[model samples]
Target: MIYSPPRQANFFMIFSHGNGCDIGTMDTFMKILSDELNTHILIFEYPSYGLCQGSVDINKTTVNNHAERAYSFVHETLHWPTDKILMYGHSIGTGPACHIASTKPIGGLILQSPYTSIQNVITGLIGFPGYLFGNSYWNNLETMKYINCPTLFIHGERDGLIPSEHSKTLYNSLGHIENKQIILLPDDDHNSISYTMSSSCVKSFLKQFFPPSNQLLPEINIDPEFRVPPETIQTSSSIFSYNPFTSLFNLSTVSINATQSVYNSMFSNQYNNQ
Candidate 1:
């Protein structure tokens, strides 16, 4: 799925979503992100997630392949220059985002609720080394050595699912990169960071690197039907409500029932133990 602003965008972001939500659930958040940053965003749907049809595979290789295809679509089909593309990933998506940023030439990178490696996450959770059972999947700490672009890592200091130390470790790993930053939200958790502080952080980060073009463009008048009702927009203290905007876009036709179950299994240690 793609979201473009009314004016020509200076940079484009290839977004990889986290577990438990598909493109359908992410529609409102992405729209708000596109509007706030005034940049085009292309969300890559993993296999068997959203409307994409294929066997589900969440390993680093499969997810990285999907991310590469999304990158090619933007570079080849959309004609966006490689230097103007930004990679944004959340949660499990950070694996592919790091892979792409390390191997490809991108403007910048944004990682939310990231982990050093899948093994590290399990080790932290179960008090056992994750590598003892199998190979390390999505070893971002190793991948960070190759990333030279400006990067931002966001995490909730109160995150219970993936501790804040994961982002801290990743931030410390990028010592060679001058334009790197990490933001820890005091009031946020693993899932609340997106709805609470992400927009402001993203906007500030873009201004530092990819400022908009000097030429002025006419203001865009959002159609009434597409404009989210003011009452529906929640304050920082309230939970975000997606019910109002759920029917506005047809791009999320795929059912999320199966996707949710798959995500739960992937994250559960019980499945890993088997």
Candidate 2:
């Protein structure tokens, strides 16, 4: 569902979804944003969600895989710097978005209706430790600690799945990469946060976070006519195939199943080569 415009621009809007959600659920927001920003938006899927399958014990949708894959695609294939991208997360999307901002050189990041951790929320709800629960997804708190980009945190005050306090916890953790802002709506719930997403203030948000420069195009001032959703996007082809940034670091050829030992070595090599 991520629409790629023909010519590559410096700025890319990357959307990461929650556990069971697919890029389809996020298309409306991205299209609206594209029309406003006059550019393309790439929304990614979590494993076992939407078109993505072949389950990994750890959710492919987790911060570890999703963040690094997209980051590699942009830096290696597109041959762009982190300064040319914006990381956007919603609900569970908050995990990868925050992780990318911490590891990638991004212009900014956005988190909507985010949670501190699923484990934390479950413990609060069930009066038991989250780690004691069979599936513990309450680890995003640790990732939020490293975010270094300008960030926008938007949470519905009346959310059911997660509370605005989660966003507050994250805002307090960031040390002002450029600017960090949080918006709370009076009667909004987790899903209803999308309604406020279409608000006119998005123009200002884009202006501030993903600024318009001769460097990157601004969102088109007009809204887009809702288009029929496509069945799939071809992701195998490289979009940034010609860039030399990737050549210098040699990071893309690594395997999908490598252990942390193999993966950490690449970063170490990159550090030594630099």
Candidate 3:
């Protein structure tokens, strides 16, 4: 996935996924996200996918690949500083998110529909004991000890495959107060969350953490007062229309907006690309 954060972006987010989702799923998400966050979003596909794809040898090893890809995308491609990115994940993606959070000084972490561990999920689904499953994601009781970033966990209360209890257990283990939040929405099942509640929780989480890197990224100026893109608004915008993340830091457009929906459609199309 390639993300261009208006060339002035500093705070970016990157992720990996569960078993079946592809870049296309991630693309739709980024489009919705771009409505609020004007930052870069990257989603990576694991080795185990389409018929010809290679097998994922180790579940835990995924953390390493995610970190490497995110780092490369941030530091090399986006030309942003290392300490400015946030880490986000969904379901199986949490393994890698927790791994990177353990090692990096992330801006924040947003985890949606995460599993406690691979063994826990497998056991829940297959009725097989953890000892019987050779491929264990053993993440349940493990990653919490290492996650150092401000964390937000969102889960579906009625999830059948991976219960919301997994999120509760991790949220309880947090060492601090301001650093954690666990939210479980009502009537939300695993596969259908996006149509119900995931988007709002995502906005809230991003609203909270998006400020940390405001200084590092350029803010777009949409001050109705300034009628034009002041070249001076580099690194921070003089306007406020494009991102609330600007005001979140306690912060856009005309030629880009005179066409309104056309620009939105173009931007939406661009943001959703993997």
Q: lDDT values of the candidates? A: 0.74, 0.60, 0.60
Stretches of candidate 1 exceeding 4 Å from the true structure: 211-274
TM-score of candidate 1 versus the correct structure, residues matched by position: 0.76
Better of 2 and 3 by lDDT: 2
TM-score on alpha carbons, each prediction = 0.76, 0.70, 0.69
Model 2: how far residue 51 lies from native, Å: 1.5
What is the TM-score ranking, best to worst? 1, 2, 3
**Ten contiguous residues minimizing lDDT sum, candidate 3:** 243-252
* Leading candidate by TM-score: 1
lDDT of 2 by residue, 149-198 (tens): 77788878887557788888877877645578888887787777653354
Candidate 3: count the clashes: 15
| Clashing residue pairs found in predicted model 2 | 36-219, 36-220, 37-218, 37-219, 37-220, 38-219, 38-220, 77-240, 78-240, 82-105
Model 1, 151-205: lDDT tens digits are 9999999987789999999999999998988889998888877653687898888
User: Global lDDT for candidate 1?
Assistant: 0.74
Report residue 205 deviation for candidate 2 (angstroms): 2.4
- Model 2 superposed RMSD (Cα): 14.2
Per-residue CA lDDT of candidate 3, range 30-100, in tens? 65554455566666555433221344433356446755776675656656555566777777667777777
Runs of candidate 3 exceeding 4 Å displacement? 4-10, 50-59, 134-140, 209-214, 218-274
